[model samples]
Target: MTDLDYFDQFDDEGTEDSASKRDSLPDWVSNSNSSLAAYQAIQSLYKEKMQYIRGHSKKSHYTKKGSYHISKSEVARAAGLAKPNAIFHSVDYASKLTKELNDKNALLVASKEKILLSRSSSIKDLSKKELQSELRGRDRYKEISELKADEIVDLTLKRLPLDVKRQLYLA
Candidate 1:
């Protein structure tokens, strides 16, 4: 038979067929989508653990030599699962779980960035004294809080480091 016929044999079997036969997005993309959905569900169910994972996962890049893809092992680690251990024996199941956990980590990072943005915006609404207090820590805020409003305004109006002034809402 021709080369085309030989390749078509696998296509008929529905095993490692070409992209034209299956159509739609790649398997990795579909898998990542399911993984992301599963991770969101888990995050809602296990908020505390997910938070811990998010905090600890900052250093883990999961990139390969030529690609930026995160590895399944790294994902599983972030999910608090041990490799070659319980709850992930089957290859297919392990892969699915890894994708879910990795996607969840991505979501965690995104949410953190969003929270920071919202917090900065909210800070702008604070009064000068309140902003100064926030920037200088609670102890400093307590001292400033006891001062008269005019005194606080004077302190805020004084020339200060740009960052401190910005934090105090004077900039």
Candidate 2:
């Protein structure tokens, strides 16, 4: 569909519900008989929607379950797809993403530890403002935290940029 046609699908009067604004399934997804494809499509749609909402509102789409978190299953239900089993291939993909995220956080933690350890004696001589200024800026911190760790590693290794390698402390 054309851009104008796609935009016209939304109600401008603020009378329609948000669900009405979401685009309908394309022909391939709508006509597919494969449950796996349908499930994947649903997951893709949820990922896109979550990204959009979080980008605008600075909010997460996760629902906390004790120490764990999960997304709502309404996206799958709306797409008429059965939720995949927890042990399915998609679970592995999710686990990998989570692991990468954790690894990235761990790297940041290690970086902080290294800085603190190296500056232990001199840190007391530095003021809070000086220390803050020495660290990565707020925007850069947010950008790095929001990035997918695997993607960051992939780009760094693929491009082999000297500055990036130095910043990441890659040998």
Candidate 3:
């Protein structure tokens, strides 16, 4: 059969007496008669073309030829977005974001632990000079970490809801 004749089969089986078919159809399908058979015919026309998303590419990362992994952040950067790891498209992008966030959180925890560890003695027992030295060390680390934290905040701001990020910023 000719390609043009292909649609004739689905159309004919669907029925000719449009009014009679309306009586047999369900309420939703019957109501669509206001648009004639256009919607139904189109749906039937592309039945084979419509496909469920089975899966995305399994590749762990996309690295341009001879280059390091092009992270989601990098992709967004290339696309001229303001932050990294902010866009979500597939499972891999979600995985990349999870790893980056978890890694940074662990660094923050480690820095806080270092400060706690530096205070070997109780504050009530330390000499004034020794206390100053310890405080200086903690402040140095805190300053460096605050820079990183700000970077993380910028990244998170691009991805998170504004109100949620506002609370984090205030805290």
Q: After superposition, which runs of candidate 3 have C-alpha atoms over 4 Å from their true positions?
A: 1-85, 88-91, 120-171
TM-score of each: 0.28, 0.21, 0.21
How far off is model 2, as Cα RMSD?
19.9
Full-model lDDT, candidate 3: 0.45
- Residue 157 lDDT in model 3? 66
Steric collisions counted per model: 0, 0, 1
Query: On a 0 to 100 scale, what is the lDDT of residue 124 in model 2?
Result: 60
Candidate-wise lDDT, in order = 0.52, 0.47, 0.45
Which residue pairs show collisions in model 3? 73-85
Best by TM-score: 1
